[model samples]
Target: MINKQYSITQAPNYWYDIMRGVEQGYSIKLTRNSEVVAMLVPAQYEQPPKQNFWQALEIFRQQVNIAELYDENVFSDVRDRCPGREVLL
Candidate 1:
């Protein structure tokens, strides 16, 4: 699967389109200050049809701790503070 990136400023305007692409198998990387802050990948990537407990724990460890560490809107901001790059996929 291919991966694409969209800045915080570009995301909300294209959120629906990005979601559609993720459903179709493209992994979308959401960026802030040119850094990948989040990824919108297919649900299948999150949990396979059947996975062992150990494998599941690995995925859990890689996840972000938004609930305990930061505000929910921290990454959702659409402000253009940092310069963005053209992410072609």
Candidate 2:
């Protein structure tokens, strides 16, 4: 199993434009000589859920009826028609 942080940024299953590799993508045997505290990665946008969490979105992905809302602007019809599924609002 892959760790959540590495899976998103380093793994091929996620980001495409890889800028560089982390520590040459290798782990040296730690012998109390390693000098490090913590690490982190940059965030991505709009990517679907993976591993065990959902991606953070800026806006609502669902569709709305424009005629019913403004009567002038046409809203998208991207409705979630999941049958027999309990969805959290």
Candidate 3:
């Protein structure tokens, strides 16, 4: 990939030119006072590997042990039974 540098001040004037360069797989370095502030490059769109519902569930089950995660004794007293403060109308 070709790399080109342009000052921040020149960006507004050469906006389309810079975008065109990026579209053509060129990397554009935007600089301010000779220091690079940002880069413009071609966007890469990657689709995640698709999984069926059953396959996904299997993977989840392997990672999480349901027996240890949902012990009834551990969850029995999780919530307070007391009613909250009553508001006066």
Candidate 3, residue 63: lDDT: 97
lDDT of 2 by residue, 1-89 (tens): 11223333233543332324332342212112243333333334236655432332323224554455664334445655568768799
Stretches of model 1 off by over 4 angstroms after superposition: 48-89
Give the alpha carbon lDDT tens digit for every residue of 1-89 in model 3: 64898999999999999999988888899999999999887875245688999999999999999887876787669988889999999
TM-score of each: 0.51, 0.18, 0.49
TM-score of model 1 (CA atoms): 0.51
Show model 3 residue runs off by greater than 4 Å. 45-89
Q: What is the C-alpha RMSD of each candidate to the true structure, in Å?
A: 27.6, 16.1, 12.6
Alpha-carbon local distance difference test for all models: 0.86, 0.36, 0.88
Residue 26 of candidate 3: its Cα lDDT? 87
Ranking by TM-score: 1, 3, 2
Weakest lDDT window of 10 consecutive positions for candidate 2: 23-32
What RMSD does model 2 have? 16.1
- lDDT for model 2: 0.36
